[model samples]
Target: MELKINRPTKGVELCLDLEKRSQWETLEARRTELAKDPTIDQRLSGGPVTEVAREITQLEKEMAAATVTFTLTALSHREWSRFKTEHPPRKGDKGDEALGFNEETIFDAVIPVSIVSVAGPDGEPVEWAPEKWAPLADEMTTGQYGDFKRAAFGLNLGEAAARLPKSLGASLVMARSDES
Candidate 1:
């Protein structure tokens, strides 16, 4: 069930019943609905044509101003302090907090790695298949792994056991399994 990598160490995979993120889908649907509605139509106005035209033109300007503008409120003091710890408050501390995620720079490094048969540096074709480690994916949205995020990745694993919820952490499987 693993999707082999293009080329690195053969990456592991798990068979997940992936589904669309509701947040992104809802945004798309709303955008489509808004585009279908015309807030001000110049052609629909009729009253001493020139006066109606002027009014319609003004309405068009206001309608244009109504375009979506995302306003991100400043993080609260507690949140700001946490963000500072994660992504520093000033330029000098950036390296210490954010590391490679510099303020002005994006995308740092990447090298293609084939998980299947590929020619090595010596020109010999090496056979490799990406290892597939199928840990059970949370099937229901209401499950413990409902969000399925990096933060929730290893709640069932050892180490950082104190960070997990009591009810959930107590259920982690600690048995050794060589099959995976």
Candidate 2:
């Protein structure tokens, strides 16, 4: 008999299209305002309302076409353990003492290690370095940064957690099904 084990070597890709996202948000707001106006006759405002909808659909297509994908790889168990040890929980009189990990500190430490590559909107490869993580994060909007952080964490930790069954019964069911 032969046995082989495969570790997780795959990277997760996350995409953010800021320009198109902002444009879509603006168009959505305009559409919402137009929707709320009780006095505006649909017949009279139809052209403007339709225009906004059309813009939204076009923007969706453009956003898909111009996606810049970021690839994040998981840290090995040993590397993850070392990172946790290096950034041990702080004990102090401050409220942060109760929280095992400081969110910002964790993000700072994890994001750089997890990011593997980035592709530009035009599908060209973009140069990236772990050292540039801070400056890149600073240039992003709050929402964009949050999203990037989430993707990094998800690739590192959340993927394993997400694979767990909801309960023991679910696990049993899955095992039994697999046996068949």
lDDT of 2 at 64: 69
What value of lDDT does candidate 2 attain over all alpha carbons?
0.71
Candidate 2, poorest ten consecutive residues by summed lDDT: 5-14
Please give the RMSD of candidate 2 to the true structure.
5.8
lDDT of 1 by residue, 103-174 (tens): 221110010111233443334544543332112222323332322222222221224532433554434443
Candidate 1's TM-score reads 0.19
Top TM-score model:
2
Q: How many residue pairs clash in each candidate?
A: 5, 0
Question: TM-scores across all candidates?
Answer: 0.19, 0.64
